[model samples]
Every structure is written in C-alpha cells, then in structure tokens.
Target: MRAEVDRFRRGAALAALLGEWSTGPGPLYRKLADALSRVAEEGALEVGERLPSERELARSLAVSRSTVVAAYDELRARDVLDRRRGSGTRVNGRNRGPRGDGRVRGGQGTAIFQRLIDGPGPAISLACAADEAAVEVGQVMREVVAKDLDELLSEPGYHPHGLPALRQAIAERYTRFGLPTTADEVLVTTGAHQALGLLSQVYLRPGATVVTESPSWSPCLDIFREAGVSLVAVPLDEEGIDPNGLAAALAEHEPALLYVMPSFHNPAGVLMSSARRRAVAELASRHGVAVVEDNAYAGQNLSPTASLPAPLGAYAEAGSETLTLESFKGIWGGLRIGWIRGPVGIIERCARRKALADLGSPVFEQAVAARLVPRMEEIGERQVVSRRQQCALLERLLADRLAGWTWRRPDGGSSLWVRLPDGASADVFAQLALRHGVEVIPGSTMDPSGAHDDHLRIPFARPRREVEELVDRLALAWTELRRHGPREETPIRPIV
Candidate 1:
C-alpha cells in the first residue's frame, strides 16, 4: 500500500510538470521554465502550493540542479511565478489581475482594428478584413427586414438588443444545440457584448466571483471588472478547462456565475470534450451556480463538430439556476447583434434588468434578427464554403513555408493554434507585423489581462488571395520581430 501511494504521488507530480506544454527542446533551463509556466497557467501548481526542490525535481526529470534554478528565476521575473526561502516556487494566484471596464472589446487587440481594412475607397471604403455578414439571408427574412424598416422607419433605429422574431429564431437554434428553449427564454441584445453585459449586471455584486479560462478572449473583461467581479481563471488545454482545478474553484469560491466558450473556444481554436462539458453541467447544477454560455462564435463550426446535450437550463429544473446562450453577427461581426438564451423565468428577470439598462434592443434590428436567426444553418453552410477554400490555401502555405512551426488543425474553428519552438512570443510577433503593415492577435490578448505572450491566433476566414498575402506578410513580420524584439507595450488601447 505504501508503494502504491508513493507511485501515485510521483505520477501526479509528473503530470503537473507536463501541464499544457512540453519542455523537451532548447536549453535545459528554458525547457524547465516553459514547463513551469504551463503548469502555473493551468492551476495545477496553485498559488500557495510548494514546488518540489531543485534537487528533488532534477533527480526525477534527470536534469542538473543549476538548470532548475535558472528556470525558477525566469518565472519569478515574470511575476506569474514565485518562491519563498522556506517554501518553493508556486503560481501567482488566479485572482491577481487588474480591474476591467464594462462592455466587450473585440478580443483580437490590434491597432489595425480601426483602420478601414480595404484602404481608401472608390464607391465606398469596405471593411474587407472583417468577415462579411451572410449574403444568403432568406427572402422571407428580407421581407421581415423590410417590414422592420417600415415599422421603425420613423424612430431612431438602434436598440440595445434586437427584434423579437430574431430572438425566437435564436431560441430555436439553442433548441437544436440541445436546449428546450422558448422565445421569452431569449433576450435580444446589442450582440454577444450586450448579452454578456446583461450577465455581468444580473448576477455579479462588487467583488463577487466569475470563473473563466486563461488565454480567454480579452475584450470581454471590460464588464466583468466593472461589475466588480473577481475572476478565477482556469487555463485552457486542448481538451478545454482544467477539470480538477474547476471543481476546486467551485468549492473554494462558491461563485455566483461561470462564463465559458466551451464550443470551439476562442484563440485555442478547439471545443471542450463532451465529458468535460457534461462534468461542467453537473458541477454547475450541483452548486446552484449560474453558467453564462457565450455561443457568440459557436455557429461558425466548419469541421466535424462537437455538440453538447443541452444548455444548463436543459439539465436543471426551472428557477434553479440560470444560463445564457449567445449568437450574433449573422455569420460575421459587422452587424453587432446576438442573443441570450435561458429559462424564461430567469430571462424575464433579466428582461427587467435589461429594461432598466436599455428600454429594449432596437425594435427593427430585432425584427431583422428574427428573420436571420432561423437561417443559421444556411449561414454556416455559406461560411463553410468559404472556410473549405481558405483552409486549403492555408494548409498549402503552411506545408510549403511553415514546416518548422507545428500546428493543430482545429476540428471546427477558423484559426490554427501553432506551437512555436524556442520560447518565442506571439504578442511580440504581432507587434513586429506592424513593421510589415500586417496585423496579428498575440496570445496575451486572449488572457484576462495581457498574459500568454507566446501564442497567436492568425485567422484564415478571409479570401484565399488575401490570406496568402497575410501568410507572406507574417513571415516577414516574424523575421523582423526576431531581429528587433517585441515592443515594450501596446501603442493603442480601445475603450470597449
């Protein structure tokens, strides 16, 4: 029995060492630091938990004690890791982050975000860089769009949410995704941002808790902090949230809400396993914790997709806890519209919350959404058509030019999560892109605050020719950055 216990401890210790990445290449010191960072980000090495000593870890991993010491120093300098004379290296607690504002910024933090993507125009300046909304919108919906135009023609058009028909359409999509939903269960909002804003408003009190993923979508943090919500971020692995850590946070914080992008999560470009999703459902239900499911990017699935059984509302009883499912941009980000799906009782409660915030989402846009929401599959199909083309082009470019960088072929998402060797920083690489007039979203932008400086999310959802041009520009940018290094800090910060 003692032998078995010792073996289990060693095994657990080794697993913690692996974390989200491997430290097999480069100098022993760099590899060790890389391994420690991965573990810390994933919450395996908790803030107060002591690390094994340099001699102890060296003996296990078969490395020199001096190498371990160098790795520890690297982490400590970054402020994400630390050590004590009596204790050992430990993670910086998940709560150590700055307060945020209210509202969602585009998660891809780039100064190029504002410059009209298509340069000076002839007829008009087109934002070609931004994915265009679905062109195949149904004629039936066009009529409704026209009707909405006539109905609200006399009034100021912008409503925080959208039209009721659109809200119902969004509700139906949730039904298809595994939830038994109704129109009233849905709230029409400005877009995913508005729906998320409602979530921050309804559940959080100042300093109340909200658990999320590391390498998360950053722009969304605005409202989380404004509501004075303290975050508990679990770093994401390819399989999704760290399950063991998630359970612990729930137990420790007994948080009021949890926000997630389980389906093809942003930046990571992958979906959570059904097992993890099911476990999350059970965890949220058992604790009576509300889950705000941000499906803002869910409908864009392009490969063999992963699906869950139901929204949290489907798993739990009415008035038990709450859930919110969002969908918007009509297959793109231009329109700025989305929905929040949950139990009508809870949604109606949020409606009161919504009314207090904004009388209602604009009447006409809501009408337009009513027409578009039901046609999601159609929009998805159109997107897939483009995705198939763009993906192949990217695959070819990567095969020919990016053989050095290893990447994951995401099953149902737009970006490729590449693992760059030798401890390179993607955020630095992004800043370098400016030297070449190209844009990139560094992994740091994906964190609650700017962290995870090593990864990048280069989207491949645009035209093949444009994407190819981007690939060439990226290569140049990377080379230039390698020569110049990352800028000290971002030159711009947009108010979300």
Candidate 2:
C-alpha cells in the first residue's frame, strides 16, 4: 500500500510539471512525450524514479488511458522512459538516446564535443565559435615558405621550448600589450588547449581545488576536471567576474590556482573591466593564488576604435601570473599555434611537459605564426567588420522570428550568450533544433553547477548565409515550444 501511495504522489507531481503540455501543436501523445522528456532531461524527474502507471497518470492528468499509454510508448521508443512488465515504468537514469548514428548521446559535455567532432551532419552548426583563417595567414605562409622553408626542413625541428623566432615574436607582442615578457617566459604548445593542459599537469595535483568563473569555457573546466581538481565557481556579471565573490571564494577555498578568461570571455562574451582586473590581481596576490589568464580572445575587439584594458597579468604580482595566448581568435584556429607566458620556472616546467606530450608544435606553423603575430591588428580589423555585420544580422533575425529570446550584445567575441524564454530548457530545445537542422551549444555544458541550462551559446562567427539558416531553424524550434503555451510552474525542489 505504501509503495502504491508513493507512485501516486510521483504521478501527481509529474502531472503538475506537464501542465498545458497537451495544448501544443503536436498530437496529444507526442506533446506529453516531449514534456516528459524535457522534464527528465532538466532533472525534475530523478533517475530511476518510478512513474505512475498509465491508468493512474491518466486519472491525474484527466486524460484518456489510451493517451497516457501512447505517451509512455513514445517515450520508451526514444529511450527516455523505461518500462518492465513487473517493475512498472521509470525514468531512465542513463537516458542514452540514439543520435541517428551508431553512437549514443553520453553526458552533456561529451555530447557537445562529439557533435562538434562529427560536424553538423545535415544541420548547420553554431557550436564552434572559431572562424576560418584570415587572408593574411595564406599570405604569411607563402612568405615563410619562400623565405625560410629550406633552413627549417634541414633542422631537426625539435624545440619543445618552441622555435626561437616565434617565441621572441610572442614575447614582443606581450611586451607591446603592457605585460613585460621575454622569450624565456613563453612556452609554445600545439594550441591554447595544450597550454592549459601543460599548466594543469605542472601545477595541479589530484584533489586540489581550483577557483574559476562560473559559466567558464567548457573545455577549460574539462581540462581542470581531468586533472582531478575540484572546481569552485564564482559568478560573473556584465563587467566580468565579481571581485567580492572572488575574494569570498578565495578565502573559503584557499585554492592552488585561479583560472580566468578576462578578455572576451567564452560564452559570456563580457570583457573584465580594468578596475576589476586590478582587484582580481590584488586578491590573487594577497591569497598567494597562482593565476592563469586566458587571453585567447583578447585582440578580437568588435569595435575597431575600442581601447581595451591591459591584460590581468599587467596588474598581477611578478611571477604570480601565467598568460595563455593562441592564434585561433586572431589569425586562425587551423594554425594550431598557442603559447604560455609566465615566470621562467613555470615556463621551463611547462616546456618539459610539452616535450613529453608531442615533442613540439609543428615548425612550419610556428614559422607562419611568427610572421602573422605582427599582422594580427590588421587581420583583426577585418574580422571585426565581418563579425559585427554577422552579429547585427543574428540580432535582427532573432528579434523578428524568435521574439522572446534575448542576449547582451557581446563586447567582442564570436558568440552570443542567449537566454531562452522562461520555463524553456535549452537541453530540450537543442535536441529539437538539431532535428530542425541546426546545432547549438547549451549553457549547461559550460556551467559547472548547471544553473545556466535555460541559456544557449549562439555563435555568429559563421558567414552571413549560414547565420540566416541557423536563426531560421532556431526560430522553428522556438515556435514549436511557444505553441505549447507557458509551462505551468512547479514547486521548487529543495537542493540536496
């Protein structure tokens, strides 16, 4: 009797969450299936939580028993809800749905990267924020071949510390940016991702705590997690991370390192203000926390005349800050060139790790990057014009077609961090959009606490036509959701 009563309560709660679901344009069964799937993916229904029987749910929802049965059948077909003759129906905790390919959708993070790696399939992907190489890249590559290919090929090409010319060029770029640096302080890696991995290997130990911004770059969080460190997140606002929150987290966690993306933060697209940057540096210094400043998106300011703040490293205590830079945002992601700037000791340590990892980044790409470093501002100007136009188009399209969707105009990044309509889940909407031939990044993948699940990261870095198609597909998904009317509110579950 007690077990039966518990099942009744679960059914009642689920019915409440599914309010107005039948009002959607789809057949009653499909509408119910979609609602249940959304609630399950959003975690309202616990994994393995037993659902009410078809008869009981039909009674609770005031629907026909056949309607309830059909909904359950649809859910089972999608592998979202599982049923057994003796065990009754339950939410599938594993929830591994078919991707139409042979692979199963894994965790949110894995699903995101797998989709990126697999390309868009029939869908237009707005997942990757990177852009194609600038014309200058081709020009510079040709120059490098004509000028230096023979000497480079004759050499062993193993300089785990990086080629001298590229290192000096990177160092010079930093010095010009007001963070006095030398070639000895820079360690080149395959890309900024590897630079971060090298730092994780060199500084972090298993079970250490690292403080970072909430809703940070997903891949950065992944790297830190892979190193086995627990992450403590601080909230961010328009000006960037809240210094007060940073101070509190530092005091509470006493973390070994602080990882930040101050300039054109990924997903969020907000630049850290100069004053906040100073405050961040001071707090890290007072706490003796080593800071990793990710400046990968620094020079790609959308406003050509905008005077951005100096890097956080400029204000940080000497030997206390490590800065990572890459060619992806400025020149091209295909070059796969990146470097780290820090105290010589840290550089030497990262260099040793880099040597063990891949021996070294390709000499030819480094040669091209060396020449391109000086031309970034010129190339960046061109990117800014194109990106600004794309952003305007995206904004207009979303306004015209998907009215309730909104985002802050990014200061200068490739993507917009868009918030969906209230009560709508991006995880569910992303699946719907994918089916409609577009791919988007859900905010939950980037957020450590999963608090941003209602948001989506829409990249505007693609060409104009692709941007139009992406927005059109997203609009179709949004219309399907909005046709269902507002979701009925459910009582908030207590946090465990």
Candidate 3:
C-alpha cells in the first residue's frame, strides 16, 4: 500500500522536522541540497509543492541566500523543482493541491511513523517547559472584578498596544531592573510568543538574516523561519555565545536581528555572562544589528548560588535597537501575559503589528498581570524552592539510571540540556520514549541547522511527584531501548 506524500508549504516547519538528518561533515549548500532531494524523494516534500523563496529558506536554514540559491539550482538541475516565470518555483511534478489549509501532511518517511504515534495511550509530556500556575496567581486572578470588567468593557476592550496600566507596570519593572524604561517603550502582548512573532513580522523581511544561539527556544526558530528570515546560529559555551564566534557571524552575515536569551536560556540553561553581554551589545551596535533579549526565565533562578546579571538593554548605548521581551509564564504559566520594552519607535511598529494579529491580549489578563507584577518576587521565592527540588530529583534519577548521560547544571531555567552517550541519537531515543509512556523533545528541534541530534531537553519544572514517576518510566524506556537498540526507520517529526 502506498501512502500519500506530505508537501511542505512552510520551509521553517519542514526544516525543523528534518533535524540533523541533513547535517553532515561537508559544504553546507551541498548538505542542504542533498537534504531537500532526500526528503522529496522520500515523499516528505511532495513534488509540485512550492518551495519557500531562496531568501526565505536560506534564513530558516541559517545559511546564506547563495547557499539556498545554489541548493535550488542543484535541485532544478536534478529536475526536482519547476521554475517558470510568473508561477514561482514549485516541485517538479503533481502536488496534492494548492497549499491553502496550512497543514503539513506526511507519509512513510516523516519523523512520526504510525507505529510510534499510535502508542499505548496518554504518555507523559516533558515537551512543555512551563509549570502549573503558582498559588498566588489564583489570588491575583480573584482580585479582578465586575467593576474592572465594566471599566475595560466600556471602551471596546481593544488596546492593540496593550492596556496602559499593564504597560506601565511592565515599564516600572524594567526601570527597577535598572533599564530605566518608560511606559511608552513597552508593548504588551498575549505572551512572549506573540511578542516575538510581532517583532518578526514587523522587522524581518524575506531572506534577511537573524542570529540566534544554537539550541535556542524551538518556537522562536519557527517564528523567524516563517517570517522568511535566515537564522544564523552561533554555538554557546558556559558563559553563552562565544564572542569571537559572534563577531565572525556578525561580520559575515550582518543579521537584521540578534535574538538572545542571556538570562536562563531555554534548553541550554546557561546565563550569558555580564562581560559577554557587553561584548554582544557593542558588537550588535557596531554591526547595526537589532537585538531581542528574551528574558522569559530571568526571574526563575532556582540555583542556590546563582547571581542575576543586568538586562542586556543596560549595555546598549543610547538609541541602539535593543528590545527586551519578558513573559509572566515563568512566574505563572496560565497568566498569558508578556511585554516588550524597547525604543518608542520599535514599540510603535510592533504595536501596529500586534493590532493586526489579535487586536490585543485579553483586557482581563492584562489587568491581572498588572496586579501580579508587583508581587512577582514573592511568587519567585516559592517557585525557586519547588523547582529546585524537582530539578535535583530529575538529575539524581538520571545519574542513577542513565549512567552515561551528562548535563551542565543549569543556573536557573526549566530544562536541562542533556547529552546522550556517543552514538545515541536523541531523535531515536525520543521516539522510543514515547512508546514507553513518556514524551521528550529531541534537542535537534531547537537548532536551526538541525545539528544537535545527540542531545535532549528534559524540563524539570513539572510537579515533583509527576516528574519522579515520569523519570521512572523514562528509565525503563531507556533500558528497553538499550536492549533493542535505536530503530533506524523512525522519521523525525518536527515539533510545532
């Protein structure tokens, strides 16, 4: 029986799915060219589906336009793409239909094989890094009343730039953090996700380059990819992205955006050192690159000996294009509140984009967040105790059961980026883990170039009991997988 091929309309999504499957020791364009051809041949990218513009794909793949251009040319030479004037480039043969529904359908070669997906049922998901809302969040929510609703509802409840009160609260928090921001410099968003998306939409043009740390937040990678921006990735060390590497990337790529998570990076969980922060700020300023400082985990330091650094914006000289994004999710996942603080002009631009996205985040959520911001430190105090306990438990269990796995102790973040024993693939381990009632995100999903196949990110911010039980199941899975060995056939499903 033959299954239908899955066509990729969005290059970023497809790129994420490919993971490090396409990565090898060779020229990047050749590797990219081979990857596309392999996927197309395997029926993942069905023939006749229009490919993303060279510039669009180049950005998402973190390669140059020339690299994408060369890859496309190689595909064209091989009759993989049909390039006729006015019709744009598309797969060479028949496609299922015009790509309208925004779904990525796959066949046999997808990372998700049918046997892997149709599991025993109800697997534990470690993919989500957010914890349950804190107890104080409920108290904050209770404070919002009919009178507040009436006041907000009176004016259509649409503040595209976010509610003035919430914006002021966010601005004040930054000022207190030493950034000295004004309310007008802040733009409230539904979440940091929306804030990042808005920035991508407003500032990024097709084929422009955006620099980010490798193994960054997976969702941020997708946002930039979908916006048709090239994502250039630089490797990170203990202190964060190496200054010399960043300098080289900046000099070569001249990126439009430099998205960094200096405080408690997702997956990696390393904070960028103060010295490195200054270097990055100066480099971005020198290269005219705009920076998006993702401080989502800034206040979630669970480490007993961790010290917080100043916001990256503090290092920015006057009028530099640096925007800091903050989310309440780290404090309370269900809060659904975030904001961006930057130059007034950037805020205005992002506000206009936000207006078109969802009008604005709920007025009630904004009001709740405003009430909660002042008490955030209180929430953090409790979260540290809870999260630290969970983190220690997971690490101990992994040490006992998965003897060869190693990870840097995070300063303070939700997840640990653990490296598997040599020759073990996170992609294969994740698939097998799913069948054993636990689901984990393979680290490769977080890389723009799909280069971290030997790594996995396990969130330690879950409930202590739940995490303990899940780790037990994960240990069992790992034992069984070791006995049977990693399956060579399972396809890597892109994490959306």
Candidate 4:
C-alpha cells in the first residue's frame, strides 16, 4: 500500500503547479477534504494508495497532526478515502472519474469554480487585484471634476485623443518621470489591457516571434496569441528573468516583441535589477526589437534603492525605439485608464487603429484618471504597509508550520513565490484543496498552456485570519492526500 501511494505521489507530482485563491477560508480538516477531492478530479493521485503517515503529512503540509487526522477523517466519512488501524491509509481503489460537466470540482467550497460556473450570491470576490479608492484615488477624482467642469459644460462630448486637458496632464507626468513626453507621443486608451491588446494588434504581425518570462499572466498570453505571435519563454530565477537565457533567446529568435515586467512581476514578485534591466534594454536596442515594457506596477515599488537606472525605453532606444505599455491599473485598477507611450510614428498608427476600434476612450473616466496618476504615491502607503504585514504573516506561518517548503521574500509586492519540496504538485494540490473548501490557483493560472506547474503564487489581499485559514487548510490537504486509502463510506456532505 505504501509503494502504491509513493507511485501515485510520483505520478501526480505535477500538482505543484496549481495555486489557490480562497479555495475557501475555513477549518483545517474541511479544507483538506476539499483539496483531496480536487486531486482525485485532476487524476494526479489515485485509488488504493497509501498516503504519508499523519505526523509526516502534517509536518510537510505545514499543519497540526490533528488537522491531517481530521481531513482524512472527513474524506473517510465520504467513502472517498479509507484508513485502517494498522495498515495505514489508502485510496478506495474504487471507480473515480472527473465529475460530469467539465467544471472544476468542489462546489461552494472554492471560488474560482463558482465564478467559472456562474454561481450566484457571491458579491465580495477575492479573485484578483487589491487597489481601492484611497486618498490618492479620491483626491484625484475631486481634482479631475474641478479641473474639467467648465469643459464638461461647454464642449461637445468625445475627442479622439481624449480631453485635451487630460492628454496634456499625462504628457507632463512622463516628462517628470525622466521620459521626454508630448501629447502626441501618447495614445490614451480605455485601460492597460486594451493598450497591450492594441499594441499587439498594431506592432505584431502574424507568426512573429515574441519572448516573455515563464509563469506569466494568462490574459497577456491571450493577447499575444491573438496577434498570432509565436511565444518563446525564458526561465525565471530569483532576480526576475535569467538575463543569460533571455540574451540567448534574443540571439536565436530576434523576437519582434520582448514583453517585460521589470518592477513587481505578476504571480512571481521577482523584480529586475537595474543593471540587468539596462542590459536587456541594450539588447533590444541592438536587435531593433520593440520592448513592450509593461510598467504597470512600477509606480508602486517606491523601494529605497541605492541606484536605479532609467526606464527600459530610455536604455533600449537612444532616441525612440522602445514601445511601452503604461497603465493606471496598478495604481488604481478601478480607474480603467491607460496610455501607449511609443515613437510618434507608431503612436499615430495605433491611434488610427484605435479610432476604428473604439473612437478614443471614454472622456469622463480619462478625465478623472488624469488627476489620480499624479498622487499615486500618496495612496499606496497604506496598501503597502497592510500587504507587507500580511506577507510577513504568511512567511511566518510557512516557516513555523511547513518544514519542507522554501520561498524568497519579495522586496515590495503583495505575494511571495514558494517552491515546495520536490515531488509536490501545486497544481494537483490546488485541485485537491477544493475538496477541503479552499480555492487555489496553481502555477498553471499564470501560464496559458499549463507550462508552469512548479511555482505557486499566494496573493495576500485578504484579511490575516483568512490567509492563516488557507495555510492551515492547505497543510492538512497536502499531508492527508499522501496518506492511506479511502474507507468504504461517503465522505463529502452537501452544504446547507
């Protein structure tokens, strides 16, 4: 039985890739049960398997031994898993296939599945993003109204380049940030996503090569694929993208677009070093490749650095070659405003395309966003403090509870990147976590094609207690799954 479980664990090691959201925030045992169900659904581990002993599983999963016992206890009740007095736990060796309808398993216990399947009554979603209407955002709204009120009254609505006042305001911001700017150099768009999409459509010809880091955001990949750019991924290390690997790819592929996330990288909070950033920019310049610099999260990094290099565009293009994607989303995601700052020629071309696509972004929203961008720093302090404390809480829990995992502390971001011990599946574990009542995202969430299965991203946007809840549950789920087989009774009970 132990050998069978070991084989199952080995076979299902791909589980490490899955990361979880609030797969649910509850007791350790219930969380475990949900996680186990998800693993079974993913087919990572199987029936009649002997899991790790309760104490060992608890230690590895970072939970209390009693928690593992309870998780296994819950599964035993559901007849999904079995335990024996002397022989150890094993899978039911029963018939198990993915539940019908292709939905993610574990109903109300998880959030991603609920959102995907259109469940109702879930108003406050903790899916993604953490920005809110703080001092910066609120103050900016008032200033926007005060600044634009007269024009709003006298002028006929709608303009291609947005309210001329906003265009000018945005231009000044760039100049202040060390980038020479003019209203003409910027193409105001609806949001960063649209800005990136437009850039892809305008600059990327079909079947062109584009290079990006692995374990990236899925939506951005969708944008690149839509433009028909063949993607080449560089392995990510402690300090953002491996410069040597990226250098090799640039030589080999000469990709048209080198998508970059230098500051607070998504999913993995790996920041790029100034020296490496300069090197990457220089390479892009030498190759004449356009760097789609996504500086969305750069504004919030306000970290006290010894020496910081100029923006990638400044280093990449001596005069004008770095096409950049800048947005208000990171500062205030609700603002839904962004701009494409690039060479004048490219900006004009994208502008023509934008007019055809949406005839310029909404005037009202852009007007307000203009005011908010200037005071971005003021609004971010509280958020940074809260997130830092939460991040610390998470690290502390991992260190104290889970002995086998390792992670690096991000300098300035909302989440940490954790690398569990070998033979663990974040992806499989994420799926299993649902059976225990928590919703997790595997490294798979960041990748479009299930490529990054080893990394796990845990965003600390929830309350500290909620974060603790998830860790406790995850530990139980991880340990229990590796234990003995299922008993001959139904374990899962319907939630009333």
CA error at residue 284 for candidate 3, angstroms: 0.9
| lDDT of candidate 3 at residue 184, scale 0 to 100 | 92
Which scores higher on lDDT, 1 or 2? 2
lDDT of 2 by residue, 195-283 (tens): 98889998899999999888888777878878778899899998888899999999999998899998889878889999999999999
Lowest lDDT 10-mer window, candidate 3? 107-116
Best by lDDT: 2
Off by over 4 Å in 3: 1-121, 304-307, 486-496
Candidate 4 residues lying further than 4 Å off, grouped into runs, are 1-127, 302-308, 381-383, 447-450, 484-496
Question: TM-scores for all candidates?
Answer: 0.68, 0.79, 0.77, 0.72
The local distance difference test score of each candidate is 0.61, 0.77, 0.76, 0.66
10 residues in a row with least lDDT, candidate 1: 120-129
**377-423: candidate 4 lDDT, tens digit per residue:** 55555456665677778888878777787877775556667776775
> In candidate 4, what residue range of length 10 has the lowest lDDT sum?
10-19
lDDT of 3 by residue, 44-108 (tens): 55565667787666544444577777777777877777887865677665322344333333421
Q: Best by TM-score, which number?
A: 2
Q: Supply every candidate's count of residue pairs whose N, Cα or C atoms clash at under 3 angstroms.
A: 14, 0, 7, 67
Comparing 1 and 3 on TM-score, the stronger one: 3
Candidate 2: lDDT of 41?
Answer: 73
